[model samples]
Target: MTTASLRALLSHLIDYAGLFPPAAVDLPTAIKNYQRDRATGDAWMLGAFVLPISRARDVPATLADTAASLPLSLLVGPDDLPPPDLQVVSVEAKTNDPAVVRQLVERWQPAMVFIELNPADEREVMWATLRELGAGAKIRTGGVTADAFPAPETVVNFIVRAADWRVPFKATAGLHHPIRAVHRLTYDIHSPQGVMHGFLNVFLAAAFAWHGMSPDNVERVLAEEDVANFQFTDAGVSWHCQTLTTEAIRAARREFCRSYGSCSFDEPRADLRALGLLR
Candidate 1:
């Protein structure tokens, strides 16, 4: 595929999470930004607005008045569920216990549920449980502290596990840029700094895995830091000698990797433009 086609493969790949940390704007401000972005020419690159389930009622009347309903992805507590009118597309819950997830499924009957796994726990049972229930996975790629970033091996294992189970997943936190780089963890003036995983790295790794690339090679792709190491064409994207076809990327995106949650849409757009990936 050509570069243009490759870009198209990533359409609606980012779920706006502006209400969360770092870009934690108030509900009205976040709604205003989402409304503005949805009106832009690049709106195809945007996905659902993410918010806590408890705040579903606070969605402003202005957004409700719009002709098109806003899609939402809610982060729900074990006991919480969104109101029926919110048009929630998916629900996310953080629980290592399979029992809690089962209860959530039984109660809410969400169209999609993303289970955030506990890194310290052995996830085979949980993954199997989720698979049986037809739920998806979610990984926290980074946080405010340097210690929050999981090792490359851990993320690689996650990709492999999800693929092995035939489950799709999405990532959240600390993936504001298109490429891997050292950056401050937050908007705080004295924020801690760490090497964050790049969105390109994660999605490309997922695509490569989908195409049957070895796990070791996928980890290498995830750890790639030099921008020149990657080449994007209409046919697909290449990292050094390995290439994943645009068709494969589209498939992985739709069925395996899904979309990631991002707090700042503008930052990602600007970074992509700076890298000449976006016009």
Candidate 2:
């Protein structure tokens, strides 16, 4: 059974994006995978279906006709404004400019809007802007190539800024495992490998940051690839010398770092089991 700290830090933590590269599976196949995911008891960790606005027309009605109405997170390009007819619970776009983010919030008032920014960019001021506007920040942790992964310092910087401003944020790409490690970047047999940031490192960094850990200490957590350093208990999560109570982890997970997008839900689950994080 998963401990309280694990549950607190990981509820609805993965927004499946099977439609995006490196999985980049066809729509029908992606839908099938999501349907199968929803059938599992582990579905509680799943979030929305990541559907690109361009593929809005290709979605089958069966995608939403499940026991619970499926949540859809539409990925929009800079110029791709979604039509009013499309139904989605959230909209995601990349832009460091707060104006474009404001436009998204205006266009989709009720639905949650997350605006992506480069972690190395001036995210502190941008996060403050998002906080005042009631919008969320998004960061890409990794891509298809090794350089696609941002440095540990930048990621920790983002977490500090986002937490300081109380701006909610979500991560995308490169985080397919539960711990920081060198891993294959894609499903292809010859896929290039890189040092991918673990979901635990990122989210735990956020949780600890939200609870007032120093950025230096948080950076230590972010850079840690050793599984022995992390201890999950009924009361809280500990990373080396630092610890966050279960409630602190829960609050951060809910109000700050919301979730990460993944192309394969199974990869994360399998990795977590391999780490003995799951029984």
Candidate 3:
């Protein structure tokens, strides 16, 4: 891709990154120069693609038939078809009593699977289930808010271990915002359970798990006056390892927190608010 096109795509990253809630511009906005953008040869552009949620049974087939140029995955619910290219998963949804998840994975054999982590069982049961599913299967694990909340450290640990097992992973949901600690003294009194913070709270949790860093060390990092310290390199950013400028890295840290930050979809502007990009 031309530098200009790359700049445009990266601009979208910043624009989306700044919003409290991650907003979807038209798919075209994500890919105006499809071929060039794809060829830009930047780490940020490497795994970048659209993730669509589908309800129809034929969604996978339809995606395979159309949108061949773009890589897409389905957030499945009652859609019965061989896992085409991408599949969304959670521990309970896949490994539940009937083993529907196992059946699907073995059958469709999608390119990747996003596994949601459950905190209730300390995530051991969930990881054991995936191990039982076999190592040859290409799968990635992720966590959702309902399964845990704020951050799912257990799920993050599973993802790291899964990597050691040759399983690659990525995350979604409850992660649409940037890093920051939240402590509304009033919220504690009103909620009585605990205070709910932003997605950054959870992202740091995952970073801590991935690095095998002590929770105490993580707390120290979190407690630091600067949130930028939490942005470290990962497999996703390995390609452009040399060129990752300080500003770019800082921007990435901010975007990571923003994209995964705390927000809800009761309104379309949730992501916008979390990023402080919207009024």
The candidate with the higher lDDT, 2 or 3, is 2
Query: Could you give me the TM-score of model 3 versus the true structure?
Result: 0.46
The sequence of per-residue lDDT tens digits that candidate 3 reaches over residues 1-279 is 223322322232311111122343344333343334455433242333433343223335534443445443434333455343433321112233225546655644543444443333344444555556641211221223232233434444443454344333334433333443333222124522322333344434334334444554444433343333433332122111112333443443332311221112222134434444233
Model 2 TM-score, 2 decimals:
0.93
What order do candidates take by lDDT, descending?
2, 1, 3
For residues 162-191, write the lDDT of model 2, one tens digit per residue.
888888999999989988989888888899
* TM of each candidate vs. truth: 0.94, 0.93, 0.46
Q: What lDDT does the true structure give each of the candidates?
A: 0.84, 0.85, 0.35
- For candidate 1, the per-residue lDDT at 112 reads 84
Candidate 1: tens digits of C-alpha lDDT, residues 42-95: 788898888887777766666565412778888998888547666778888999
Residue 263: error of model 1 in Å? 0.8
Model 3 misplacement above 4 A: 1-66, 83-98, 134-168, 181-208, 218-225, 228-279
| Worst window of 10 by summed lDDT in candidate 2 | 61-70
Q: After superposition, how far is residue 233 of candidate 3 from its true place, in Å?
A: 9.4
Off by over 4 Å in 1: 61-68
